[model samples]
Target: MPQESSHADPAPRLHRVVVIVDANSNPFELSCAIEIFGLSRPELGRELYDFALCAAEPHTVMRDGFFTLTGVAGIDAADTADTLIVPNRPDTHVPRRPDLLDAVRRAHARGARLVGFCSGAYTLAEAGVLEGRRATTHWQWADGFRARFPGVRLEPDVLFVDDGDILTAAGSAAALDLGLYIVRRDHGAEVANSVSRRLVFAAHRDGGQRQFVERPVPEVPDESLAPLLAWAQERLGEPLTVADLAARAAVSPATLHRRFRAELGTTPLAWLTGERVTLARRLIERGEERLEVVARSSGLGTTANLRARLRRDTGLSPSAYRRRFGTAVG
Candidate 1:
């Protein structure tokens, strides 16, 4: 539970975080915590986070249909934690134990950072930590969350909502995004990128949980576009035309366009634009170069074009994006 640093020193301090898991905890959310903070981060030139897995009671059954675990480090663990993470609890089945609620409330009362992933927000709400915080949970549970905690501000569309000391993320996948954000906030963008690389997950997604959930699963039958997509990504700096794409994919321009829309949910040009913008954002986040330099390197060609596209997509212009995420400048 180390505090998020405004300016992380070259060698940042180590932190202690505890994952409060219950029988109904989602394995994916737990795994997200293990990936980000539970495991050793020596590769990121950091010391290990004092991470522990604590269950509500002595022996708790997991959601995986198995009666396992007692690694429960009493509720006292929360008292000394630098940060506390609550992964999805055992669905909304069993009511939370009073001991569990008291422990969470005690930790948050003393200014410890409290985080909830997915249905984990329920526990925070139950503990009264989210009384005035803007929080979110799995979209499917929005109604239930509102019904239970009318005092808490709920924003259902965001992947994750950060209200100062209290943070809540939506769904299992958004857990990964929130975890990375925690790393970013603590150690800066570089450490977050390193963790993302180690985990083999994208550092960020364009939209919220809606984008991820409603994303169309493409038909990967005889019309697989993996090869063409790979080719286009490598040649992003080039001015790619419909004919150029069709020639590379060994299909007619019309056929290529159709496949692009079907597989990626966007036309060839649009997808290319997205790719360029994504690349530019990453470069900017990395604190590598100036706006014009990043624009050219990421294939956006010019700063003005990068600014227009970035603002439209993220509601933040290149300069703002740079200042917010650019480590060197910041």
Candidate 2:
């Protein structure tokens, strides 16, 4: 008998991500999932996820029968998924298949993170997992969603909602935003940025709405807020105020405020605070040990402030977060 070679060390388990493909599902959102989680990335020097698509039926016709999706695993794949992407059905009036809903409920019950893209919120709600959970769906269907599922707290204005185990993204491009966010959450800022660069997408998008656009009409645009944003990012260590930001932009504070709301859908002070908090998170993930130093470097100013902000944004204290995501312990 031939000698048997010793087995190599067991490979590490990659996170399993399964997307549910159902009838009338939009191909755009499905493509978003494939781009984000399914595609192999040799450029990243590692595989990010074990991705699969599953449906109640083997051959399902897609949105308006644009195409038929086949060669996918059966819906039972949801049982083994670490994260489940719910179906993104466009027809809100049509009910989801019972088996698909049951799979979603089982995934939720097993504590697998569940995601809904666009009208996929309808599927999650239909599964009864989104009752009282914070979520966002297509803005156009907000009224109908509210009327149907009064228990689910719908946030229509935002790009996405991250409620721990359950997440939802508004229609279309918001799917990319939420997907990038999940990448950031699971991997880290650097990894997420790399993936975004590959996709030609913004890694940490600041806002969702073009609620308003402030610029010169019938003429060239007055100015883009990009320059101001770049300047602020460079000076995050300093104690910068909204007024200082306005002055740097060479505009009155009031005009700056309007522009902030119009372009970013957030107030100036809120944006500044958010930026600082983001910097603080990056610092923590980089294994910065001193809480006060992380706070001051990020312009959050105090250890207490850093702790509060970290808790609010990450649901973890600074130390806890470092332990979870840090490359090396300080």
Provide the global lDDT of candidate 1 against the true structure.
0.76
Please, what's the RMSD in Å of model 2? 3.9
> On residues 1-330, what C-alpha lDDT tens digit does candidate 1 reach at each position?
988989857765568899887776777888888888888766755454778888767777777765566767866777778899864764664578788888898888788899999899998998888887899888788988899899999998778887878888888888898888787666545566678888898664432334133335557656577788788889877777668888998899888777775554456777777778767777887775688887788788888898898887656777776677675222
lDDT of 2 by residue, 256-291 (tens): 999887776777898888789878877877777999
Best by lDDT: 2
Model 2: lDDT equals 0.86
Scored by CA lDDT, what does every candidate get? 0.76, 0.86
Worst 10 residues of 2 by lDDT: 207-216
- Report how far off residue 6 is in candidate 1 (Å): 31
Weakest 10 consecutive residues of candidate 1 by summed lDDT:
206-215
- Give the residue spans of candidate 1 off by over 4 A: 1-12, 207-212, 215-292, 299-330
Q: Using alpha carbons, what is the TM-score of model 2? A: 0.89
